[model samples]
Target: MTLVRVSRGVRMHREAEPDLAAHVRPLTRISGSCAASHDTAARLWNFPEPERRPFDRRIHISRPSGGARMQRPGVVGHRSRLLPDEVAYVDGLCVTTRTRTWLDLAEALEIDDLVVIADYLLRIPRPEFEGRAEPYATREELLAMLRRHPGKRGLLKAREALALARLGADSPPETRLRLAMLSAGLPEPEVNKPIRNDDGDTLHAPDLSLPEYRIAIEYEGESHGNADQIVRDIEREERARAADWDEVRISKRHMANGARRAVEKIAVALRARGWRQEDAA
Candidate 1:
């Protein structure tokens, strides 16, 4: 019988198929009551990450103190004292709660990367939630969680990232772009800003905007390339122009390759419309 190794001393039929999170789950159990946490827990809960890792990455697990670390060929174990509320279940899989998983990421992620994940968790999908999707975790909840772990390894970085976390980002790229702008010393623009005409009727809302400067920065996702979306985009551009707003559209290519240039263009537009460096303060 040919068996594939899933984790140290754990194996299964080669044809049994594998789900990354599922495969990771048993490792936690085999290690004696640990839970899939950190990146593994985040994946099981569908948490948005700045970048998705590969299947081959080691499974991450966590447990309370006084237990043996789950050292295995394919597992990376974390030892932490978990609170009752910090452990939860999803689809019957034991994992860290949302805020707990996020706190776990502090030491493992860069400040900007941490902020991206933080913003993602707080995003509220009002339309999908019948005009009120409660946030996955409020900013206050995150701050409180950080406060509880004062001596944790990366608590300071976590606190800083949580401070920049906002509730309106719709995608990881939006969070990335916003951070880029702020890093460039630009004032934070409103996310999904509303546009209204002289009569005060809302026309459209752009992805990010500085209303005082009448400048909008929109992230054009791959879906924007479709014929129907392209047509609508053209119309949206025209309406934005009609509203006397200058726009700088950013795509994944711009984000991955020419982000500096894209952000500079936005700065130029902002400056042209009277934004000063001191204004950001």
Candidate 2:
């Protein structure tokens, strides 16, 4: 029977299916106090990160401050002051709390990227579909965690991200789009507000909206390319038109170069709907 080496001193059957859990479990078992953290923990929690190089296979583990950092091949270890409450268990493996993981990432991620994670945590989960009723974390919980870990390496950046983070952002692209508009001096757009028809029934909920200006903006991810999704999108746009709302559709390409092109599209829509450049001033 051929065995594939997964980590140092850890092996599995060559024909066995491998997964993140299979890799992480052995490393965490190396020490009772050690737990998966950083990017490893983020992955376990299903957090979204910005596009980067190929996925890293190394395991990131952390323990309380007194212990020496775990050093071994295929492992990147960190030592930090991990309070008991700052750690949690996910899928039977110990990991950092969602908010602490966010704080830890502040050192490595850009402010906007951090905000992307923050927005994700703050988004209200639909219990029926997501199997949870509440958000992953609350803004107040994040603030309290920050207060506990002042003077840390990325405290400043984390605080800045928290200030910019807003609820209702459903995806990284939506958060990035909102940030780009703000940086470009465009008025902040409302996130995911429902547009209702004449009978006061919800017509469509835009990813970002300026309801006062009667304009709705959507970020079209690659999934929109699906034939069925395209048909649904057309129907949605038709409903918006019947409701007297102008819609701006954005795609990944438009988000390039600091979302300059995306903002231009939205700005034009706003201008035609009675918004002015000076109004934002």
- Give the TM-score (vs. native) of candidate 2: 0.90
Q: Between which residue pairs do clashes occur in model 1? A: none
Query: Best-fitting candidate, measured by lDDT?
Result: 2
Q: Write the per-residue lDDT of candidate 2 for residues 17-120, one digit (tens) a residue.
A: 86887778778877789888888888877888655422245788998898999888878889988999988876778889899998988767778878989999
Give TM-scores for every candidate, taking all chains together and pairing residue i with residue i.
0.90, 0.90
Candidate 1 achieves a global lDDT of: 0.80
lDDT of 2: 0.87
lDDT of 1 by residue, 115-204 (tens): 878887888877764476687888888988988887998898899998888878888888888888888898788988688766687878
**Candidate 2 segments whose C-alpha is farther than 4 A from its true place:** 1-6, 52-56, 197-201
